[model samples]
Target chain A: MEVEETRLPGIGLRHDLVTASGRRIGVVSQSTGARHVVLYDEVDPDAAAATVELTAEEADAVAELLGAPRITERLSRLREQVSGLATEGVPILPGSPYVGATLGDTALRTRTGASVVAVLRAGEAIASPRPDFRFQAGDRLIVVGTADGVARVRDLLRSP
Target chain B: MSDAARLLVELGAVVLGLGVLGRFAGRVGLSPVPLYLLAGLAFGTGGLVPLDAPEEFIEAGADVGVVLLLLVLGLEYTAGELVTNLRRQAPVGVLDLLLNGLPGAAFALLLGWGPTAAVAMFGVTAISSSGIVSKVLTDLGRLGNRETPAVLGVLVLEDLAMAGYLPVLTALVAASGGASAAASIAVALGVLALVLVVALRHGHVLDRAIGTGSDEVLLLSVLGLALLVAGGAEAVHVSAAVGAFLLGIALSGELVERLRPLLGPLRDLFAAVFFVFAGLSIDPNDLPAVLLPALGLAAVGVLTKVATGWVAGRRAGVGPAGRLRAGAALVPRGEFSLIIAGLVGGAVVPEFGATVAAYVLVLAVFGPLAPRLADPLARRLAVRAAERTAQQRAAP
Candidate 1:
């Protein structure tokens, strides 16, 4: 699980890692938000056997697909370990006050003392979204905190 | 024909000719610089069909080309990257300067050019073409290689050095007396430092000033600012190209990314003109006399450039094979050398332009081939390393 990070100067950054199966993978992230998943050739090691380019949005979608389950699983384990801690999935109805607004605009954590762990939109989970992440109608937010804090978050989302 | 119509026809034809040459270069997997230079020579004085109508326009376009070239070059890296790479690769950078620069200086001295021409030649040979090198790395899919960062570090350091070197060269070229040259150098260096501080500390203010969603507004402001600053720098006797470069450094963030595509085509057009103008300035007849000297210089330039990369790659902990790749990647010398030639303009030595033009033509054409040639040697080194590793395992 050790990744070597190399700065490409003008280009961007590249993170290279070797999997347990001995496959060398490199992800090149350009300054302009272009990404390339590079698989190295076993024979040459320095040469890329295959490189798949991804746009910024496609990269985010791929990350969301891979990230959702693991984050929720970790949260569920934390819930089991704590006595009063709760993790709840709160749905954003069509008329929620935060709908179509950024995650930061809601000020949900400051208002309710609950943290948003992830967002579930159209059955896809986006984990650990930044403040800039926008909320949409029909999106479900995963809130984690004390039971009271979680209840407050639910109420806050429903409030006009 | 009316004067305006004549200018339009000649300028249009020259640009169209350049476009055809560029396409040809692309098809043949070569840089268009040499081809553009050849085109310039073809239409220049004493050539097959000498052009007179658009001479003034070409001259002006060439000036803009140099500015835009430096500006775009400065935009390639942020100030942070420049500082970091310089910190890490300062030794390699110094080594690069000595190894690559001295040969050209020595060659110039041997040719009996004065100290000024020697200084000019030092730059012509020292700096590798970052544009060609990067494009080669990308085209070869070597951007993901272990040795690439080291290669890029060397290029960045060379570019930063140019920020300082260009002013010195420009001052020396402009000043008639040694004392005046010294004064000009001091003033240029002072202005350069001022620009650096502004670029580093108040870059955000500049970013704020020019940050706009509208492409047209952003493009016009950046270009106009670049030209204005370039003109101002020229007024102070600092090179206008350096002024454009300083403007580029003072800009950062996502706005630079937005400005790139808009500036790219414009830069390309002007840059092409600059290269052709470099060729146009030279007499092809003078090239024959300097060809021998240029070849000798080219031989020295290739070895020195590779040596530079070898040292840099080793410092970065790259393996022997990867070091060769790094060195090979650095062999091409292009626009910067021509910029030096353009500055020198045969003012120091009558044959300076032809010598540099011939030298660049040789290297730019053959430098890209260095990496391909190094592959076999690199493969052998890799095999030896694998064999040694296997032997070590058996010994244990």
Candidate 2:
């Protein structure tokens, strides 16, 4: 009998991808971009992963399962660059210009090299802030950028 | 008609007159609180429908109003927003309090009142007029600006400070009242803690319960919760207002949004009665004796609060217009001040009570007039500052 496959949203594979003997056949990696989710999979430990891009609808369904569409998008974006970036990991405070600025201000963009993808304020997520958004005093910014870029942005924000 | 019937008739008449006067005042851009107060004055000591009640009864009613107001205030909790608001306003709040309090205390001493009386008076004057400031800021469309959150934060701190000060001052006035003071403070802190913990933990549950399709249950439960907390506070010797305020803090954000439309009108009605009763408490005969002191205090209260607000605004990087607006906003004192004064009077010497009432009456009259003064002051200050900047630029 053919085993049923399970597909996850922003991240790729739908298959249990478990072998007949219960051996794992593949790992699915999901990442997000500005407007879409990129999904690809690793078939074997020694083999290069096969990249499978999912449509926006597929990504939204997976995002709903993950309970965080914004995080899903962010993870999908990161996964596009790195095939196996963990989706469930806690995001560290980004080194971005928005570190000190209120979540609503355009100053976040000016101050940090990275665009603020979202903000976690008072236990809720605020995504894609407008130019006039005031950065609250204690808001945590989630940003998207290169590792070095994230570091630079984080440094600027972390400075008193 | 008997006294009870006459009292009801007077109250109804006052309410009707107030509704008309309030509408006129709002149309003309004045606040309704002061109008209600003035209407109280007109109907009570200053005009025809003279309903002379004992000071104790009116004061008790005012006390109840204060408690209810505080309970309503408790329903407006925004702990989630407090960090941002507090961080922005801490410096301004501290500076405003000191700047206002020091001078006020000195001024009181100059009037030859003893040190204790002077300090209590300073507390009364140091309180920035919350009603006036909020109303004018809203009217000017500046309530959502960066400066406003800070100003409001400072006001919250001031309110908390006032809560701490009230019981201590009361105890100082009557040494035997120390136990009640401790009890009140303890209850206040305990209630605050309980409300915050519960709100933080089970806020979603409460939100869902409130949202469930039972309007009567929701109203009753909310009111019942407020009263229960208030009763607990009262049992421990804390003011009902403290409990109410804590409840308001807890109910802020989603809860406030849900409950305000339902409860706001009721709050206003009680508040109106509160002010009218405040008005009714005053005796026409005593007005002459208290008039000069009241006028002096009112003038000082308005000027000092404005000056301190201006200083705080400037320090917070507010522009000249903004500074002037802040100053104007701080001009009107309200129910809180009167309530504090009554507490102080009852706790200390009864004579001081009369003095505070006269001062509050004066504030009620002039508080609404402050915003009218602000528009011209702000424009004039802006023009003057701009001219000075232009002159300096031309000099170079």
lDDT of model 2 at position B267: 75
Q: What's the true lDDT of residue A99 in model 1?
A: 76
Off by over 4 Å in 2: A1-160, B1-10, B39-48, B52-64, B103-119, B144-147, B167-213, B384-396
Please provide TM-scores computed only on chain A for all of the candidate models, following their numbering. 0.64, 0.40
Per-residue error for B1 in candidate 2, Å, reads 5.1
What's the lDDT of the predicted structure labeled candidate 1?
A: 0.88
Winning candidate number (lDDT): 1
Chain A superposition TM-score, candidate 1:
0.64
Cα lDDT tens digits for candidate 1, B1-396: 999999899889999999999899888888888899899998889987798988878989999998998898888778888898888889999999999999999998988998999999999999999888998887777878878899999888888899899889999999999999999999999999999988988999999988965999999999999999999887776788889988888888888899889999999999999988988888887889989889988998888888888888778886777888899999999999998998878679798988899999999999878998999898887677667767998995
lDDT by residue for model 2 (A40-128), tens: 11211111123334466765565556555466466567758774332221233455444445544445455645666666677766666
Clashing residue pairs in candidate 1, if any?
A: none
Q: Where does model 1 sit among the CAPRI classes?
A: medium
On residues B38-102, what C-alpha lDDT tens digit does candidate 2 reach at each position? 55666566555565643345455565567667765545435554444456567776776776667
